[model samples]
Target: TDQVQEVLEAAGKVYTVLKIDEVSNLGAARIRVRSLLAALKDQADREAEAAADAAAEKRGCPAACIDLNNLDKLVPASFTEKADGVVAAAEVEQREGASTEFERVQFTEEMRDAGYTILAPQMAPYHFELLVPIFKRAGYNAVLLPSVDHGAVDAGLKYVNNDICYPSILVTGQIMEAVLSGKYDTDKLAVLITQTGGGCRATNYISLIRKALKSVGLGHIPVIAISFKDLGEDNPGFKITPKMLYQAIYALQYGDLLMMCLYRTRPYEVEPGSANRLFDYWMDACKHQLQRGVRQSEFRRTVRRIVEDFDTLPLAGEGTKPRVGVVGEILVKFHPTANNQIVDVIEREGCEAVVPGLIEFFLFGIAGGIFQQPIGKSKKSALGSRIGLAAVKKLRKPVNDALEKSARFHPPADIYELAEYAEEILSLCNSMGEGWLLTAEMVELIRSGCPNVVCTQPFACLPNHVVGKATIKELRRRYPESNIVAVDYDPGASEVNQLNRIKLMIAVAKANLAEKEAEARAARDAARDGAPEDPEPVAEAVEVETTEVAE
Candidate 1:
């Protein structure tokens, strides 16, 4: 154990030490040790190359010769020549004292008194819509921008690089369109966007928004970064107190519950708009409670009531619709506009949509920290990761309990359980945008009675490609009855093509449902005829796997 520890320490790595006595076979142990050494050598080579590239870049030589870290920077020198005109125009603007520094909006008492409205881009309708009032109760004037339309997408493409992820385009476009619409006074307006401050390009969205604003002559409007970390510390007035954080957490939980209930009840509601009307009612009520400052006990009681209200809705239809789960990149999975209103399309195709709750994403993010520690080389990171996992788990308990009380809703699996499930196929170190969480969500969906899934993602998102689309085969092998399809959404992707693919998935889902129903009928007949209560197990439903790539 001491020798192994020394070897690992020399390699600048860490591992759980096992005693030599624990190895039952010396030959097997030797082989495992050799494999570990090989992996360490590969890691060391990569690090040495990265260091060399950094040294070269520091000496003003292009890092591209040694490292392909950033694909965007790998363009040909001719691309730079082509950009000269744009650069020259920008330089002229710069000379005119055009501010390059991204302005941060401080949520001070003065700004609040002046009624400065903070505009946030809408991702999930119920979540964002309810979040507005939560911000208001916490003493900030906040509003979620309206749903993204064709105009928003067009406006987004105008300001943002089309090659970037679709979610960023829509978000940036929505804020830009809102500013350009001249609907609000520019002086009193500020745009709020979340910064993950991580490897994901989403952290740079604030910079993108600032540049877009500068280009559109809206740079005077402050851009506030909404992040839990110090990334958004430029605005000291936007204090996230413990109380405010508590309320916000509950708000998210409630939003997810409401969304779940809405999706479940909407398709079968006797009245066309009954579920929507109730949804609106709860939105208003939740907002009112937020304004009054809801207590923890009060929130718990309120959630139960909210669930009961939705449960009471008249669902007069057949109620046996094919259930389909939606999973993918966070924005594309939840944002209706980004995916061209896919949930509605699923319903139109005679299926009930089951969107995994937003809270699971939060849990997945927290649990990712715990997983990172085992493979991570840094001690500080490991410690911080452990602390973060514990803190989030503590916060998650109440929300998890509330979700459990909502009888009709399928409570999300524990974060550790999700990580365990994901580990069976994906490595925990595969932490990127969505990462292992995307794969885990698919597994969760299949486990939680929704076997048919639609994995929505931006066209060619590498992380999703690795962890999402790539994991489907393994998932199908494990859950043979599972039917999954990957749908790519992009600016040029046709709605007709997307829907046609989904229609086929729905066709398979209907057949699977029919088969299951037939098996159930057969079992019932056997029981009635005084035969064996347990009939022979039904054969596995044929899997329908398809990848719908956007043109």
Candidate 2:
């Protein structure tokens, strides 16, 4: 037992050194290693238990569901096959002669009468096009808001408190400002926002925007929160129709695939705007397919054609530019609510900004539901079914595959591994949400390959604070060379304060790079002198010490 303790101590020390020496992201790496180790142990335990269950079943006793509370069983194969059948049957619901012609003509008249204009978040062109017809079908004028710009951002920064993400303020500001500008009647115009009610600032954005409106005395205007879930209870009630939900989810999946391809091709193209242009063209094609109710077979052919076209675009940007991986609170990471025009800021700093999409978060949510332990007979019986098991597995695969594929390009850290780390953290804390995973992503991304990370959360957001505040120390201890900054956005946070903090983080990143270069130079000189390099030893340090250094 003494010898075993010594071995563990030795392994821990080596783990610390290897983690620190190879990457500048200490928090994510340490968390990742911890998670991976736990996952390995969990997997071993599951396999053994499964084997025992299989043997018991062979002896004629039926295999009982594993503790549903502990492990989310995959949906059984039978369910997957049945789900495929359901999907196929639903495809037949597409109308061959669905007449939007009458609705379009009527909407055009209503728009002229009410002076109503539709506003959508600045989404990929593909998404916008698909959404436009849907909004039109619902009876409104719609256009994707222009990409966020500096002037609009500046105005929003002036009014918005420093603590809130800048982009949300600007975009909301733009919408509000547009209403006030008399370009459209205040009574006739409305803007749309999406709500997930998930673990992020996005869930609260509608309230923030509404409050902002009230402050500006624009309280009469309607702000629509298009929810895929039951998020907003106070606002203008909009029940999601089955047709609407189906169309919206399909649009989301289609947009996700296109965005993935666009980013992948953008970095390697030979002609600037080729990818963007193809994206535009594909959006039109996708809209046509969806509107005409084209079969899946036809949609696949169109996607293939789009992919081929994307390959022809030129990669115009600097290929070797430093890449900054952004993680943390899902909404803030993807939506502007958390990060405050961070992608633009990073681009201005001459770095490529990579953000994980919404699909992964959705997968997390669904799988999280499955992971819930069964409380009674219903849950146990449900878990015993093959369909339930297969459903969970199917949902999990896309996210896992995407994570692994994304790692190949950016290679900073393993987020999936970090998920387990977060799971363990939640297990210990008896909690789960965007907070635990967002914090874990910070540690994982840094460990995987990205030392520079910006974690955005809402001011006074307890869960996010719990995840982010403690990471400062862990980050430093594991990656003394890593650069991380947490930005909290609210109506009152000053822009200067947020930017100043980011500036400091950037400076640290630069210094870390400089030190790395110096070390390489020193190694080359030592080699010339026929001297051996001496590796530094590792030590166990508390989170506070690292945070102090960062401070």
Candidate 3:
């Protein structure tokens, strides 16, 4: 009763709508209260929406007014403002059949044949490295932005709205810096931003990049939006054929397999550079395989070879180091620059960084749409997503089989498993930023023996805060042994502060591990002596805190 009371207090004050003792059965009490609470919550939400709509009517268009409000939150001045006569100026331009050139320029099919260079942001190092070759084989002069430098941040700060998320600034900066560097023909250079067509601001970054470039006198450089969605601006200039798509899929599988192998093997290798040297060799080999158009069987053979090489590498500390999982916004979670070399920092702190595979994120996206049929997802769209999900599973079998056969490697969890893990705390409908997948990764990591976790994100991402930081207390309650920390990266964030927080989490993890080992030894001794008595429960030392700490 005391423990139950403590848990209830930690969760927040619980109101008794229908007392369990007052009802005929416990299940009836829960059902009655659930229905009542849901009806009241819906009513409250509707009232709030109606009130917001009334206020927005006075302010202008509801959606635009909301956007304007978000933009002007930290300052008195409006971030998006037009001059008083701008509407009349637009009318005059309409009458004269001439207009100022703020219109978006499209990348036509001609640009592809002309050998225009395509610039994409660096998200996953291994995945993009593999993709560049796959892209070249299909004939696109592709270049992943080499790095996100300070100059890019300066450029982004100068043009991007102050209220935008930090990732948008970094990405915007990287793109603009590349355009201004004179590295490519401004007339023929094109930039690419992958969009999910989701509710996140990332879906609109294409326009933000375009606006920034136009402001810097580099408007002639076309900004291309790459996506599976049938958007009007989805690059008529470049096309991905069915064959090209399959090759890219294999690259994702190989890149994930290689990443898992490298992170697992590199920290403990007997030879200082052997793990990295072998990884580089395999990356080159896989690129060639894709270029040569390897069959599914051939791809499976390569996977086995890659695994055998990594597994056979001589290592000292196979399981000595505690595993720490990193989860959050995709770019910051995977990219070194965005998170300030967190994987390296984790290894340096005597822990192995266990990042979730990148492919699962794509799987989560496809799976989300399939499950959202009751909430506006079309039947046809849901069917397509189901087929895509199944196809991805079949496509993944080669790598899965190879990993399952390895002594040191293991395959990533299925999308359905991740969804089940997330369903405990949050609905799959909570899909934005990293969405429920963020919470799901922490659960998966804890269950997979990586109890210490670092959840990284840009400071101002709303959905991240909702799904990442907001769920920590509940997660702590559900899995008391887990030690998790939330790190938000911003332009002005301190790396030293971030390091100290990580060290604290690691300290707790080490203690937990020591306690677990001691318990195991005691259990072994008791088993040999006759009857074993119940052991005392181990109390978790780390407590949940909602404060933002930068990574």
Location of the lowest summed lDDT over 10 successive residues in candidate 3: 537-546
Off by over 4 Å in 3: 1-101, 147-150, 524-551
> Worst 10-residue stretch by lDDT in candidate 1?
538-547
> Model 3, 1-551: lDDT tens per residue?
32233344454323334544555668877788888788768765675577568768777864634543354564454423453255346445522223333568777889988999989877788888888877788778899886435676677777776557888888888888788888888888888888877889788788788878877788878888877776677567777789888888899988899989989998899989999999999999998888777688888789889988997999996987888899989888987888888999998988888999888888878887676766788888878888999998999998888889889888888888888999999988888888889999999999999999999978678989999989999999999888999988877789888888888998898888888888998888888885436533212211212222321
Better model by lDDT: candidate 1 vs candidate 2: 1
lDDT rank, highest first?
A: 3, 1, 2
Error of 2 at 157 (Å): 9.4
Which runs in model 1 stand beyond 4 Å of their true positions?
1-112, 316-319, 375-407, 531-551
Quote the RMSD, in angstroms, for model 3: 18.7
lDDT of 2 at 457: 61
lDDT of 2 by residue, 1-551 (tens): 22233354544322222234566668877787887787667865785687568766777655455453443256667766876697579656733432211111112343334646756655334455576665555545665665444455555555455445544565566666565666776656656777666654556556656656666776655667776456524332233466654455455555756765665566556766676778877777777666645443564455455555554555554444555667655545665433567766765665656665544455444444434444222554435433533543443344334434442233222334546765644432312345455656666656655678777766545666677756667766767756788776665578788888777777676666667778989989999986555533212243556778999
Quote the lDDT for 393 in model 2.
41
| Candidate 1 Cα lDDT to native | 0.78
Q: Of the candidates shown, which would achieve the greatest lDDT relative to the real structure?
A: 3
lDDT of 3 at 69: 32
Say what the RMSD of model 1 is. Answer: 18.5
Give the alpha carbon lDDT tens digit for every residue of 198-237 in model 1.
5776777887788788887777777888774567356655
- Per-residue error for 286 in candidate 3, Å, reads 1.2
Per-residue lDDT, model 1, residue 306, is 75
Ranking by TM-score: 3, 1, 2
